[model samples]
Target: MSDDLLKRTRAVLPSWLAIYYDEPIEIERGEGRHVWTADGTRYLDFFGGILTTMTAHALPEVTKAVAEQAGKIIHSSTLYLNRPMVELAELIAGVSEIPDPKVFLTTSGTEANDAALLLASSLRRSNQVLALRNSYHGRSFSTIAITGNRSWSPTSLSPFQTYYVHGGQRYRSPFAGLSDGEFIAACVADLREVLDQSGGDVAAFIAEPIQGVGGFTHGPDGLLGAFAEVLRERGILMIADEVQTGWGRTGEHFWGWQHHGFVPDIVTFAKGVGNGLSMGGVIARAEIMDSLGANSISTFGGSPLTAAGALANLRYLLEHDLQANAARQGPVLFEGLRKVGSPIVGDVRGKGLMIGVELVRPGSTDARSADAARGGGPGEPAPEIAAAVLEATKRRGLLVGKGGLHGNVLRIAPPLTLTADEAAEGLAALVAALEECTP
Candidate 1:
């Protein structure tokens, strides 16, 4: 049945839209941390639909809210006063941490980021922008311009003149051998150089607290804070692209930027806010949010249905303190991956449920091995080994995701409600899979 569907999908869908596995499984349903294929084969879900199913599969609170809201009304354009939208915005503003915050809803992270770009460029009166190397913002025309990862950026034409800077990822970095303080200083120097060459009046500096598609990699803590101080001095706004790192997924903080020791001028979010619903938003100071002279409205941005579902999802996440759950479970999962003892596993890093296991060739003098030998360097990225491990894990009834500049990093992000037993089970399966694929 899946084969037929796969054939139809391939015939119609764009080839650029990648799917996982040799034979992609059609997920028919899900509950909690597991999903079932069309053939009723159950697999432990580790990716959580690319970290979208944030709370749990089929969460009752979100489900009920969507159903109830749909019964009354699904959408009424932003022209009317939307109660659900207002409620959700109020909640988001309360927790946004930005001073004098204002909220604008959108359908996806791409749109949210597009809105942010609009605000920054208009306010600064310049199309020049700064973005982190090895970072991804979105797929839209405006966002692809700022994306540093070439694989994701389909074109060079862009409305904004974007300058890529260093220091998003520590491993595989030119400054990888430096101490945290030294690394931050080098990155700051690099930023200043870019600013000097950028012809000045750079609009904003955008970054992910943790690079998601760059394989969940990040620099030393307070690195962005250091960058922020420099950008602020030059009147450059800081925009935190928290699409993957927001809402306590990082565990230590409700927002990933909080880890950087400063608040951003603008914060954009999506992917887990509505528990798999199509929702995204941006929060900013009223001055920036209202900078535009003309009128604008998102026809379907804060529709009744999505806003209600997102509101319920947020309430549940906070009430249950899923952020704390991530904090508790993240260490258990992180340590388990470290203890897997796979020769191919080179490095494990990230906070909370958002963890990455980078792969390398066995017996190679990679950074992990070099560090052990007091050498300290990066490994040759082993994308082939990563591919093999993906198939092996699937055969073992586990589902994980992969990404990296070299495509050699395994991304393990389960739902925040992950149980202790589930973690152990997933770890055992991962260990066995690695052993099966090991040379």
Candidate 2:
């Protein structure tokens, strides 16, 4: 049945819409942290639908909210007074760290980012923007221009003149050998250089606290905060693209920017607030948000259904303190992966439940061996090894995701409610998979 569906899907879907695995399985349903396929095979979901199913699969609170809202009404465009939308907005604004924050909802992270670009460009009256190297913002025309990753960006034509800077990832960076303080200084210097070449008027400096599609990579802590200080001096707004790192997924902080000890001028979020609902939004200061003289509204942005569901999901996340859960379980999984002692596993990094294991060819001059001293330098990206491990893990009834500029990094982001036992089980499966794929 899945084979037939795959054929049908291939016929209709765009070829660029990448699917996972050589033998793709159609997910039939989900509950808690596990999902079943059309063949009734169950697997523990680690990637959480690319870190979108944040809280859990089929969370009852979100389900009830959606069902109840659907019975009442789904969407009543943005022109109407939507109580649920307003309530959700209020809740988001209260949590957002921006001064006098205002929220504008959208349907996805892509839309949220697009809207943010519009706001920043319009307010600053300049299309000149600064984005970190190896960043993946979105697939839209505006976002593709800012994206520095070659694999994810398909086009060069862009509305903004985006200057790609250093410091998104440390592993493959030119300054990787530097100490943390030295690395921060080098990146800050690079940012200043980029600004010098921008002819003075740059709109914003947009960045992901952790590069999601770029393989869950980030520089030293406080790197972005240091960059923020420079941008602030130049009247450039800092937009924290928290689509993957928001809603307390990072564990230690509610927002990823908090980890850096800075408050951004604008923040864009999606992927966890609604758990699995199609929801996203931008939060900014009132002055910046209201800078647009022209009227705008998202048709299905904050519809009653999505808003209600997202509200329930956010409430549950806070009440249950899943952030604490992520903080607790993240280390268990991280340490377990490190202890696996897989030669191909070059580096493992990230915060909370969002972790990445970079695969590499051991013993190569450009690659770090499993037992190599820490920060020996990033090894040669072994995308083939990553592919093999993906297949092996699938065969072992475990699901994970792969990413990075070269697709050599394994992304391991599970639902925040993941337990220690489940982490152990996943780690065991991963260990077996690595052993099977080891040369």
Q: Estimate the TM-score for candidate 2.
A: 0.97
- Taken over the whole model, the C-alpha lDDT of each candidate is 0.92, 0.91
The best candidate in terms of lDDT: 1
Candidate 1 structure quality by residue, lDDT tens digits, 165-194: 999998777787799999999999999999
Model 2, 299: alpha-carbon shift in Å? 0.5
What lDDT is obtained when candidate 1 is compared to the true structure?
A: 0.92
User: Worst ten-residue run, lDDT, model 1?
Assistant: 367-376
Query: Against the hidden reference, what TM-scores do the models get?
Result: 0.97, 0.97
